[model samples]
Target chain A: GIQVEQSPPDLILQEGANSTLRCNFSDSVNNLQWFHQNPWGQLINLFYIPSGTKQNGRLSATTVATERYSLLYISSSQTTDSGVYFCAVIPFQGGSEKLVFGKGMKLTVNP
Target chain B: DAGVTQSPTHLIKTRGQHVTLRCSPISGHKSVSWYQQVLGQGPQFIFQYYEKEERGRGNFPDRFSARQFPNYSSELNVNALLLGDSALYLCASSLSVGTDTQYFGPGTRLTVL
Candidate 1:
């Protein structure tokens, strides 16, 4: 089984500010994804990066498999970005491929 | 195409009662998985089904069970619910059982009283 740890459990940022979140996994993972859980409880997929770097508008993520860590960066953050960001990994343990989620980083972007 | 869908956005149950939750995965997806999200915590894996077979089970009690249908839809059954079982149940559909990305449903809020 793989253990995932997300840093900066709580983050508060002013609108238009920038922040970065980090995730570290205990073992090699076959898959990694970032999700944003909105205030309304809707889970939205942000990125599916197993390795390398990817950018989607104001948000971008980079996963370094060898380092067993991933980083998510938010640029010019908006109030709407206030929510929990989850980092999930699948280590393919027992051939299940079940995703193990970290507690997540709670971000509050105040306007 | 439609994303994953779940039935009965919310539910209320009492101790010693049995309840069934349903999920419809996104079109063209073949893997369905369930997770439980307690308040202020991340979702924990429950069960995963691929190709109508049980692929994985979480650390949940034996009272919790689930099965996948022929059409890739799935149902989760919890028998003799306990108050601690109250939480949000989320269903996710993946393009495959291994490394594909997973999309989740809005989830069903279950309140076990």
Candidate 2:
């Protein structure tokens, strides 16, 4: 089983501030994604970056497969951005495609 | 296009009872997976079905089961549910079985007493 660890278990910031969240996995991954669990308990896909860099609006993500780590950046954060950010991945091993999710980083953006 | 949809947004049951949750995946998506999200914890994989076949399963007990229909819709059934079975059940659909992006539904909150 692959272990996923997220840094900064909890974060609080003022609106418009920027923050970085990191995810470290214990194994190589062929599928990696970032998700946002909103207040309503809906899991929203943020980024599906297995490698390289991708940006969506004020949010961006970068994954280094070799290092087995990924970073999610939120710029100009808004009150709506307050949610649990999670990193999920499937190991590159054969016949193993189950997505293992990290415990998540809880972020609170105050208006 | 409509995203993944789940039925009975909320449900309440008692221990030793059985409950079934339904999910309709996005159009053209043939893979449906189920996950359980306990309070204060991340979602845990339960089962993955592709082309109406069981592709993968997690560490859940035998009491948990799921099946995919011809239309790619899915149902998760739990038998002899225990108090620990109380959690949010989420269904996700992907274009293909493995290594594809999965779009999740709003999830059904199950309360087992």
Candidate 3:
């Protein structure tokens, strides 16, 4: 079994500020994804970066598989960005392909 | 083009009762997985089904079971539920098994009394 740990379990920022969230896994992974859980409990896909870096609009993510960590960055955050962010990964195990998740980081963006 | 969809947004049942939750994957997706998320914690994997066959299972007990249909939809059943079973059940779907990005649906909130 692999372990996923997220940093800065709680964060608060003013609207238009920037923030970064980090996730560290205990084992090698074949797939990694970031999600934004809205107040309604919907897990919205943010990025699917197993390695390397990717960006979508004001959001970007970089994963260093060799280092077993990843980072998600949000710039010029909006009040609507207030929610929980999660990082999930599929470890390179024998026959299982389950996505293990980190405890998550709660972000509050005040307008 | 639609994302994963789940049925019965919320449910409440007494201990020892049985419950079933349904999920429909995105069009053309062939893998579906189930997870349970307790309050203030991350989601835990329960089961993974691909092309109507069980591919992987988590640390949950036999009380939890799931099956996939020919159409790639899925249903998760919990038997003789306990108070600890109360949590948010999530359904995720991907284009295929291994290494694919899994998109999740709005989870079903279950409360066992």
**Predicted model with the maximum DockQ:** 3
- CAPRI tier for the interface of model 2: high
Candidate 3 regions exceeding 4 Å error are none
Worst 10 residues of 2 chain B by lDDT: B94-103
DockQ numbers for every candidate?
Answer: 0.79, 0.81, 0.90
lDDT of 3 by residue, B1-113 (tens): 88899999999999999999999999999999999999999999999999899999999999999999998999999999999999999999999977899999999999999
In TM-score terms, candidate 1 sits at 0.98
Candidate 1 lDDT: 0.94
Task: Give the better candidate number (1 or 2) by DockQ.
Answer: 2
Off by over 4 Å in 2: none
Model 1 per-residue lDDT tens digits across residues A49-109: 9899999999999999999999999999999999999999999455857899999999999
Q: lDDT by residue for model 3 over A6-99, one digit each (tens)?
A: 9999999999999999999999999999999999899999999999999999999999999999999999999999999999999887686899
TM-score of every model versus the real structure: 0.98, 0.99, 0.98
Give the poorly placed runs of model 1, Cα more than 4 Å off.
A92-94
Candidate 2, residues B6-113: lDDT per residue as tens digits? 998999999999999999999999999999999999999999999999999999999999999999999999999999999999999999966899999999999999
How far in Å is the alpha carbon of A72 misplaced in model 2? 0.4
Query: Cα miss at A107, model 2 (Å)?
Result: 0.2
**Candidates in descending lDDT order:** 3, 2, 1
The better candidate by DockQ, 2 or 3, is: 3
Clashing pairs in 1: none
